[model samples]
Target: EGMDVVSFASSAGPNNQQVITEQQLSTLFSNVEEILEANQKFLLSLRQLGFEWTNNPQHLGEAIKKHIPPLKKSYMTYATNFYHAQVFLLSLLEETKPGPLMSYITRWEKEVIKIDMSPLLSYLILP
Candidate 1:
């Protein structure tokens, strides 16, 4: 809690010196993690079904029944909470060109978060 706002916004110009709070960052990661964890469980359920699910159409419903609702909820939560993170990221991107924060965000984009939710949302939203 002994954070220095000056150091946090050191690279930013006077007009672009809005520092991202720790809570905002935590919200971003927590939302993303919830989606990832929910998807992982859904994938695991599908994998567990394996050949039997492919062979029997009925098994597909049972395999996904428990996983889908929670996955959908997690995605909805992520979608709702992502705006703050997007603003934070954009601010950082604007301030930290050719710097460590830019590289860190780039690495995080490629490796930590490779999520594309359009297709998943279509499936989740369609009854």
Candidate 2:
């Protein structure tokens, strides 16, 4: 899918010049989707735990410990890649006008780039 909005800048053919290639965008979106999927899986497991462990408060720590490793791995992946992605997007925005890539950048910001994972990282760092 693609997004569109009004553009005050002049139109240029796809081949005229490229700020980012199609392949780069695809890879970026794929990474974001993978991270989202991992987080969703982690949340689902926690929900399931809430039901199954409702009567086992003492053993909650043991159950929760198993989920943390994978969640940490997923977040570590994000922390590793996020800066490069941010720099890439910011540079692209600086180079191009607000028309062609605007919708895609907006989607990236809303879906993935806007995430603030610092507080979440504290959990991993502390325990």
- TM-score, each model? 0.57, 0.52
Tens-digit lDDT track of model 1 for 1-127: 2122224433453457443445754543435556667777888888888889668978889867888899889777766766655665566656734455455445544543447524211322212
Quantify how close model 2 is to the true structure by its C-alpha RMSD in Å.
8.9
* lDDT minimum window of 10 residues, candidate 1: 118-127
lDDT of 2 by residue, 1-127 (tens): 2212112112343566443455545433324445556667767767767766767765567656866787677667756766555555466657646645654545545554346534322322211
Give residue 34's error in model 1 in angstroms.
1.6
User: In lDDT terms, how accurate is model 1?
Assistant: 0.56
Number of the top-ranking candidate, with lDDT as the measure: 1
